[model samples]
Target: MAKVKSLDDLKKIKEEFLSKEELQKNGDKSLGIVQIKVAMATCGIASGAKKTMDYLINELDNRAIDAVVTQTGCMGYCYAEPTIEVTLPGKEPVVFGYVDEKRAGDIIEKYIQGGELVGDVIPVNYETIEEHNIE
Candidate 1:
């Protein structure tokens, strides 16, 4: 591989890389896919969350899974940078922390495919709960 000389070269290199990565993405066009959310707060960015988020987007696109990848504000998980939330269609979103390539892969395979929970989880909470137990 040669060094990127210009913007055009960089674009070409990226395209090639995406093409190569897409070959391994087998869940293309699979229905009932899950959506992914990566925290992109100031803390997350400082902890290399941007790169992980980009990697996830690329990987998802390569696999051709129709997933929505977006960012969220601080989830109070600054210690676990590069955190992500995977939302399956019928289930609530499951938050994964300290995510990297390996965890992302595991998420795609185990959680997404198997419908099982991963190691780390960030519970979804609301600011307040309404009392619905009226008799």
Candidate 2:
């Protein structure tokens, strides 16, 4: 193998591998705003998780929303197959369940863009922890 002669050659190679154009074109910045994650569990995948993922990617690309989409393992909510997680800047992450392509669109539109909570919220376990007992 040919050794890199100098810093300039290494830089050129690095530029090619991590090119701005390529990053913008293929990196996880297409959404340009939020980050999306779909739980591709066995049940989720069986229930068409990939389709939902594609819908989100296409929708974001079509609308030119800057965001990144990733896949995760079982979210432990198997009953709610095809679950999704949305992480907005400066906000707590939200997990949605029983999501399909249509619901995916709704999520993108309502939560991601409109900032309105959509339907089908995964019921959370709220335990009241008494901070201090009054005398």
Q: Model 2, 7-102: lDDT tens per residue?
A: 999998889866653444444533224768899877889989999999999999998887779999987888888899887754557889889988
lDDT of each candidate versus the true structure: 0.76, 0.81
Would you estimate the TM-scores of all the predictions? 0.66, 0.67
lDDT of model 2 at residue 112?
A: 86
Candidate 1, residue 132: the lDDT equals: 45
> Which residue pairs in candidate 1 have backbone atoms (N, alpha carbon, C) closer than 3 angstroms, thus clashing?
none
- Per-residue error at 127 for model 2, in Å? 11
- State the TM-score for model 1: 0.66
Error of 2 at 25 (Å): 21
Q: Where in model 1 is the C-alpha error above 4 Å?
A: 1-33, 125-135
Per residue, candidate 1 scores C-alpha lDDT tens digits across 6-25 of: 99999998899776545423
